[model samples]
Target: MKTVCCCTVLLLLVLIPTCCHGGNILVFPTEGSHWINMEILLKALHSRGHNVTIARASKTWYIKDNPLYYKTFIVPVEQSLVDGDFLKKMFSVFIKLEQGTLTLTSFFQMAIGLLDKKLNIYNSVSSFVPALLDNVELMRKLNETKFDLVLTDPCWGNGAILAKYMNLPLVYNVRWLMPEEAHFAIAPSPLSYIPMTGSGLTDKMTFFQRVKNIILYLMTAIQSTFASKFVYQPLCEKYLGPDCDFNQIQNDADIWLMRTDFVFDYPRPTMPNVVYMGGFHCKPPEPLPDDMEEFVQSSGEHGVIIMSISTFVNELPEDLADGIAAAFAKLPQKVIWSFRGPKPSTLGNNTLLTEWMPQKDLVGHPKVKLFVSQGGTNGVQEALCHGVPVVGFPLVYDQYDNLLRLQEKGGAKILTLRAVDTDDGFLKAMQEVLNEPSYRQNMQRLSRLHRDQPMKPIDTALFWIEYVIRHKGAAHLKAQSNRMPWYVYHSVDVVLFLTGAVMLTLLATVMFIRCLWKSVCRRKVKLE
Candidate 1:
């Protein structure tokens, strides 16, 4: 009887927390690198005994059905948001933009061409919400699930729409919310210091740099307005009623699980609900595969250099590839290049080219000396987490900005894509990073700072996730500014109101003094 009682107590201790805290979480994630970040968070949620269900498009490129981690709520659509050849074409445009090789007229023409295709892709992605809503059976099933919250990446506007439609408390695994960075939407971003994405300016800026930042900020606002009005507004009006604002719906999310921290990002104003979990996906190095370990061991004292340009861009222009290969040929360090193309003619004996690589494992490896990359957020953060300095050739999107942060921190050396193809630029950048002790020292310092947090970033993220579930929603933490109109949020109305009040007071005093002077003059005339 005593043994059975003890066993029952132990079982209750283990089972009680799971029973109390475990909640149903519905995830609507973005594709590509964003999905990779979401997957890590989902796994952590699953391990904590939460039930995770993913509502993914039938034509999604990256998301796969995995019964162990989450159940799938697949929504079939006519078109895939991303197609195989789409990335190749997009890569070409990015390379051209980075190279600055096009004439002014040609650049605009090329940009317009790419913009049209991009809009089409956006249209395809936008179709997801309507398709889901029209599906009576799927809607019925999702309704019956009794999910506690909807976890989504607000990069795709449809997720926010779905959450609002479902009437579930929403949480975002966010970095970008469409037309601008997530911070621009939720936090106070002053153009004087907080660098806008693609500005390529740091927090500390010159007078002219601030002017440029303001211009970019305006451009981003215009773009955001355009996207909202054209892409999301009509959908919101048709489905959720005319008063439903897409931007407001996104802003009303219960929690913003920002995928960046001050370690990688500049210090800026953020909201209470915005939790930083920058390197949450990063973990200590696991052992490499036997073949990879053998090759890494062969590098010996000189160490290894690993290069990956991320999911897209399998091949570079022939000349650019040749230049990179030639540079690696001169390096004493062994190289592992994650590539998928016809091998470059100038490829070196020291370099190993594979279609794919274990990027996190290689980054964590003790023998890995340098990370040569395209400056994707995941790759850069992984390099930082492992204390590996970087040589970057930033292609497009936030890649340049991501590398700029590391360069400002003295942990990275960046070479423009065009620059790398010329005048030994690629080789020089590589050698400088490899030889510089400060680069490694600074990165290791950052690693220490990133690791010194009281709770692990993943744990912090999970806590906030479950915190929102337990509380039903984190509405108290959300700033009222999110719901306010633009004039009210910026205090423009208050400024105008105060200005008018002062003007009226001054006018009244002036009139009274004039009247008093007139009376005094009249009395003086009578006395005379």
Candidate 2:
């Protein structure tokens, strides 16, 4: 009995150190704003006694604001590719192309420039690759510090590669739907699958849209394969060693942290590793500003409209702005527009325009009845968290998809830019959304569902992170993709083709046997 007790004590000593000295977390966020939410997650982990470190791009503004929170490192690649006269020329050509005023030769030149522009855009957003590599080298030099896990914003460039090179368990935090992995991650949307978003639409052919979708899918598949092989693989090989297989690394990731709620998306089969940590941006209710509070109380229960195009739509077209100003000028209720640029002179006394506003704070205000937004995923989550019905004007990427889900839920109205160009269209859409009580009620229902979650999103995220640390790695949660061939991975098409082939073979065999049997029977009768 004493020997057993001693052994148990020894085991406890070993495990206590291993478990209590929680593993270090390496975070690579796409931008400063992403870090804000990540910081909250890290704080939650810290409360549970985990050591966390942030390795982020230097140009990110949040780094400067909160130096104590992170161990900062500068990336070698320049964040912006174009400056001075070159940028001006590119912008001028792009504007002309957009307006359909460019000559054929100029159009070709613009096309080449646009391709270059895509690279530039990627560079501006994902220049952290070099810096992350530097961090790896720094870790190697220290020899004492080894990270147990890597948490990266998969929206940025090549974070998966870095995680692989480190041989650390990776948890991808996807801010939006990944174009390359959309079919596997979520249901394929016609818009993303057709013409590949930026390609020009041609009117010459029948069933052209379906053809376009097929072609785009094939092209995207090829491009994704190449990116995995050439870009992502080479980086891993260069840092980790020559023996590392990039394909295997993707399969080895511990989890995919999806910022999507089941309430918003339709039911779909997801891997065990894929966790829904949506609505991390949600905050508890707070008091509104004194002036705003006074206004809300004095309005005799008349509601307010909150309008913002989100950060991506920072440069709204003058025509669109004018249309919005004109529409709002005629409205009876107070309108608060979070315009990023100079205040438009056309807005009437009932409307207020500001360069910046506390978005969550404004959304939670009792007077805010409706939200007019560009349908950014984060903005939509915030609106839903605050029980504000939306008037979504989706601009690009998955914004359209997000709004479609909300509209289908009967909690929002979708106003496409194409329709919003006309004054009557904009006014009618706004009136329809604002005057309807069902929209408000539906939003409230969703808000209640979100609030009644089993656990806070931040807490859930932290628990998973710690769970991984406690277990050394939650590798058991990872999906086993390496065992299956590509055909088997997406086997619905293969199964149909195989079934057809088998049926044809059986039919042919039956016909041949019937012919042979008839010939034999005829010969026997003749002989008799």
- The candidate scoring highest on lDDT is 1
After superposition, the stretches of candidate 1 with alpha carbons farther than 4 Å from their true spots are 100-106
lDDT by residue for model 2 over 153-260, one digit each (tens)? 665446666776666778777653224533243332344322343233321224766577668667766755655564556666776778776656655657677777
Report how far off residue 449 is in candidate 2 (Å): 2.2
**Candidate with the greatest TM-score versus the true structure:** 1
Model 1, 1-528: lDDT tens digits are 999999999999998987878999999988888889999999999999999999988888888889999999999887777675777677876787777765788778878987787777677788888889999999999999999999999887888888888899999999998868999999998889998899999999999999999999899898778777888888889889999998898789989999899999999999999999999999888898899899999998999999999677867777778888999999999999998888999999999999989999999999999999999999999999999999998888899999999999999999888887778888998889889899999999999999999999999999999999999999899999998999998899999999999999999999999999999999999999
In candidate 2 the C-alpha lDDT for residue 338 amounts to 82
TM-score of 2: 0.78
Residue 151 CA displacement from its true place in model 2, Å:
0.8
How displaced is residue 117 in candidate 1, in Å? 2.6
Score candidate 1 by lDDT: 0.90
Candidate 2 CA-lDDT value? 0.66
